[model samples]
Target: MEVAFSGINIYSKKPEAVFEFYKKLGFRVLEEVAPDDKWYGSTLALQDGDNAPIIWIWRQSDEDNSVVCNHFVFSTNGKMDEVYESIVAAGIACKPPFTAVWGGRELILHDPEGNELLFL
Candidate 1:
């Protein structure tokens, strides 16, 4: 079978905050759902025209059935340092960048919902 990776679904008690986090990281909102509706969420991408991965933020609620992965790694394309600086400047608590034993530079941080996000 031929397949292509496209996106990830993130669940959070405060989806808006998660969306805002991505926005601060340079992801633009492609579509958004009303908070008062059944679900609150936003589809985001680095650039509208690029084939880059998409991020789907969905609100966590008792009525919803979802499986969540609390950790995710994203490629910064050698911009890990810049991203680390921006995240810190935004007042987000994150560990300083470090070189991995495997020889990759990485930065670790948690989103509003406490999901670990590692940038490499």
Candidate 2:
């Protein structure tokens, strides 16, 4: 068997707001599809860089069915500082970048819907 990570599904109560937050983080919207009778919710697929994993933001169809996790880590490609600055300029609150116990640098912030996003 073979497998590869392609994307993540983020269910949001206010998906439009979530999408704007991601856009500020440099995610370019590749496509958007609205929910139909056969689908659950509307969705927007986004990517930050060439070959980067796509992020799918979905409007919640069932309030109780939304999913949450500890966090999601995004690679900064050696531009952690620049990313941090951009986040701050966008008025997004974030913890200052710091070295992890594993010796990698990271900055942490939360999305509009309160999902933790870590940049490394």
Off by over 4 Å in 1: 47-50, 63-67
Score each candidate by Cα lDDT. Answer: 0.81, 0.74
Instruction: Provide the lowest-lDDT 10-residue window in model 1.
Output: 62-71
Q: What are the per-residue Cα lDDT tens digits for candidate 2 across 1-120?
A: 786677778877677778778877766667666544323333334455555677777667663665686488778899999988988898777878999999999898888878888888
TM-score of 1: 0.80
Q: What lDDT does model 2 reach?
A: 0.74
Tens digits of lDDT, candidate 1, 1-120: 987768888887778889888777777788998977657878998756667778898888977666565787878898878888888887777889999999988898877777788888
Models 1 onward score TM values of 0.80, 0.73
Q: After superposition, how far is residue 86 of candidate 1 from its true place, in Å?
A: 1.6
Q: Top model by lDDT, which number?
A: 1
Backbone steric clashes in candidate 1, count: 0
Residue runs of model 2 more than 4 Å from their true location after superposition: 33-51, 62-66
